[model samples]
Target: MPRSATDLLDLSELPAPQRREVRDFVQFLLTRQAGAKKPAASYRFSDLCGTMAWKGDAVAAQRSLRDEW
Candidate 1:
């Protein structure tokens, strides 16, 4: 889940053992459903759509989406 490579990314910067606490809270946020909230797949599709238009082709973009299943 780390988007970067650095020791400064860990919870050592906190005052106590709150890493697990923070992780749980973030996981809850990711899985939460409110109103028109959608899963991670929706965003992936948006990403694919964006690239497809940029590259002038949508064939590989669609295949990338199917691979998620």
Candidate 2:
């Protein structure tokens, strides 16, 4: 038989301040877990395909960068 969390941890043995800290930590963990179950926001790179504006010569820019290296 496995021992449950309540049985394994005797919160009564801890001081009042420490107990409150533990309680706050447990609440944080629960909130984090609930958030984890939610689906993450998604992004599409294709949506930004033609959003950029370029004004200079592409090959000239490459040669200029290479010459500096």
Candidate 3:
């Protein structure tokens, strides 16, 4: 019953090709773990401030809408 990675694997005893395969697998797992820990990009309302094209006067539109209510 191996309690740790070092006890579980004796890299020096493995054949060269098998050792390379193990190393590649370890690198893949490490890369995947690092990618998982990264935070997703954050968004802000300010980023969308000028994205839309307004066709009419905003204040006048609001007033008209209010009058209709």
Error of 1 at 48 (Å): 41
What ordering of candidates by TM-score runs from best to worst? 2, 3, 1
Better of 1 and 3 by TM-score: 3
Candidate 1 residue spans exceeding 4 A from truth: 1-10, 33-69
List the RMSD of every prediction in angstroms: 14.6, 6.3, 9.9
Off by over 4 Å in 2: 1-10, 43-52, 56-69
True-vs-predicted CA distance for residue 23, candidate 3, Å: 0.6
**Poorest lDDT segment (10 consecutive residues) of candidate 1:** 33-42
The global C-alpha lDDT for each of the candidates, from Candidate 1 onward, is: 0.61, 0.81, 0.81
> Compared with the true structure, what per-residue lDDT tens digits does model 1 show for residues 12-69?
7666658767766666665563433844544466655655336545888789899999
lDDT of candidate 2 vs native?
Answer: 0.81
lDDT of 2 by residue, 1-69 (tens): 986444556799899999878877877887899899999979787697846677999999999999998
Best candidate according to TM-score: 2
